[model samples]
Target: MQSLKEGLLNRAFSHIYVEKRAMEYELTKEILKRFKESKVIEIEHYKDIFSRANQDFYLQKKSPKLILAVKQNNLIYKGADVCEDFGNKHFYYTSIMMNCIYDCEYCYLQGMYTSANIVIFVNLDDYFKEINRLLSMHPLYLCISYDTDLLALEGLTNYVKKFIEFAKENSDLTIEIRTKSANFNLIKHIQPQDNIILAWTLSPEGVIQKYEHRTPNLKRRIKSIKEALDRGFRVRLCFDPILYIKNWRDEYRDLIEEVFSNIDADKIYDVSIGLFRVSKDYLKRMRKQRPDSIVLNFPYDTVEGVCSYDKELSRNMIGYVYGLIARYVEKEKIYI
Candidate 1:
């Protein structure tokens, strides 16, 4: 058996698959510098590796590889129904990368993608150009980091900084960068902009310890949010996808209290409260991936292809949390 340290070293990007075209990009070159010891293999397209079959997602996640490629088409997508649009008429989301570094047991990425290896598109200029074209028509509310946690991978991709600068220049564009990472050093130096909303997803400490693998604890994330608020950034608190655990109400109540005690609610841009929901197909696939996971195995009701708690349970969950948050935040700024 391999020692734990040796196993970790083996899993940490032993090989890097780079597209022949992406090899020329400066971002690709910078990423290569960080993994000099890993073997570099050139491919014609990233899908050649990322879309392969018979791959074990769980095993590959032990030490996922890196795929650097250029995005050729479909730069932006319409936001899904499950996602909160915040009443924006021109709401959309774009994925510069796929698959997250963290191993959250309830993450939808596990079912959405066939591989656990991370894919980073090196051509972000193209994404910005597409956004600019859309902006020409009307104002846009874009979610820049939906499929992956861009902030956590900021050291390798530097996309968060680039997006912040992009949002700073385009006043008509409001970008939401949601993350569970505590890597505040990446954005501490840059000045925050009103158009750029830094949204952090918070879960109870019990949930974080049980389900959210490799993610920062609740306290660390709160500290990062405090720093962002102090720097004049528009911060949004998200108690989304509140897990249904034993004593969930008490757990979440304590979580809310802990959150409010640390920061001033007046500075918050908004708060979003949502109960757990996932696509019916995605949940089916998730069940096949990890059949033993208690969180994934819940018997949720399906409505129009979306699986979630029964209507009454979901209503109570959202309503209870909404009531808790409303005490600290204004009702007008809260979204369900």
Candidate 2:
């Protein structure tokens, strides 16, 4: 978590650009109060700066600016084919924010967006209205934190708390809030809801230290998960996007063992596993952006438009991990 002096970032922003229309929002006023040190520039629209060309993503990432805007349309979207649905037919995702605070080497966002600046949509009431409309149609499975870590930014946004309240009011809506953050205390006071699945992406310590930059350590994350379970929240463990780091087999093996050692597999809602996979276009851009990154430079095989490790390696990795997890968790409870 960022300290009070750091305000919005570890690479703290010097300026926060607010949309002319967004200034009236309660969230905007609340955030501005915290960052009195920053220069608050009012803009006609967020994209005037957010989508501009020739912006240096690497340099911007070091001290990214924050943009407060009102999201105009397409409040909800069908889940991409590349994303795992976990057996839900109505799988969908919505982004209240544009970028993440942590910078993982294999992150698809680097290839997906041109700028690294963080953009927050202040019109969250609109998002809730859209979800309410969709819920009328049928039961919905929504990924609320798809593009950004809402939990990590909860200190500034209070978005996760709002979502927890929204989920409680609508039982038919199943929401998945995935993150690498260890900031569970932000919402620990709220009563846990069965429809809200809190997911933490678990990587080996070596893997986290090497690539998952600026995120919490393994020990801290496990401690948070334990607290969540003790507080009666249904927690999900995600070993998804298993990277091919050196001695990865030993690393992941110990990771699985360490997790089950402290966490009761029965108490865990479920486990999710998957190998690193990205779009061909995203991989191409990532290779260009991070030419020196070891993870990005792997000679992955392309199946259709997606790039990933060869089928043999993927199968071996997943199968091996599956066996280890199955020792603790039921096979049916695991999602590949």
Candidate 3:
């Protein structure tokens, strides 16, 4: 259990674990008071926080600030086609939360924002409004998590559960909830939704052990997803940001086998493949904070502001992973 403590907004907050039984009213009140001036992008009753204009304002450097956004009436957004389309339309993603709890060495948040303190959007209804507007236009594939893993933070906030309920009610839209956390207790409370897909980013055990910090191990993560599937949840496997590690193919091959053997392929909604990539500017900031991290030290090419594996290598890696995964799932169910 993590305890929530108050500190100056300028200082980085040490991780606080508040026990479920010890969630006192005073603590919530004090936290609300301390973060009073943070900002309210929008608030809705039934939906989570939609969007905030000031989100990019705090990305300059890591300073601890409590961001609490309560979504009120409008929750959904008419998503732009640019967010989901890749190669031609562009990769589309939407974030209901502002940041993440785990600190992966290769994560963009370290370079994307300065503060470690989390921002909770207390409202959920307003976001639904925006989503409704978008669904009316086309058969939309919406990435519910682009920035933060709402499922990881499900213990603290039930926003993901509520969102899952919303997705089940509205089957016209495709929603993807991507996360690395292995919190399974939260899923027990809800029935699985067909249109809502739970995508887990599968990295080799060595890669996760070496680079991912404060995240669940591969075994625990796989077990969690299995639990979701046992309850009929639509599961999606994502082998993204394939690292250029030694014996990479052997490691990834074993991982692919491990995942399919443990979970049912027929139940899988889709599979996504991508190689490691980060904005060059973001990588620079990550290096300064973690000077010895190998993720920052890797050789990469600059495309626009993003640092990535050579184009040929990236293409090959994506192809290889996609092919391997295709062995278990149909091609149409595979998304790269």
CA error at residue 220 for candidate 1, angstroms: 0.4
Those runs of model 1 whose alpha carbons end farther than 4 Å from true positions after fitting are 1-9
- Model 2 Cα shift for residue 181 (angstroms): 0.7
How are the candidates ranked when ordered by TM-score, highest leading? 1, 2, 3
- Over the stretch 1-336, how does candidate 1's per-residue lDDT look in tens digits? 546644555656779999999999999999899898999999999999999998878777778999999999999998988899998988999999999999999989988888999999999999999999999999999998899999999988889999999998999999999999998778899888889999999999999999999999999999999999999999989998898899999999999999999999999999998888888888888888888999999889999998889988998898889999999999999999
Q: Each model's RMSD to truth, in Å?
A: 1.7, 3.6, 7.5
Question: What's the CA RMSD of model 1 in angstroms?
Answer: 1.7
TM-score of each: 0.97, 0.96, 0.76
Model 2, residue 184: what's the lDDT?
94
What local distance difference test score does each model get?
0.92, 0.92, 0.68
Per-residue C-alpha lDDT of model 2 across residues 31-97, encoded as one tens digit per residue:
9999999999999999899989887676577688999999999999999987889899999999999
**Which residue pairs in model 2 clash with each other?**
none
True lDDT of residue 22, candidate 3: 24
Tens-place lDDT per residue, model 3, 209-277, is 888866899999999998988888888888887888888888899999999998889987777777778
Q: Which residue ranges in model 3 land beyond 4 Å of their true spot?
A: 1-65, 70-92
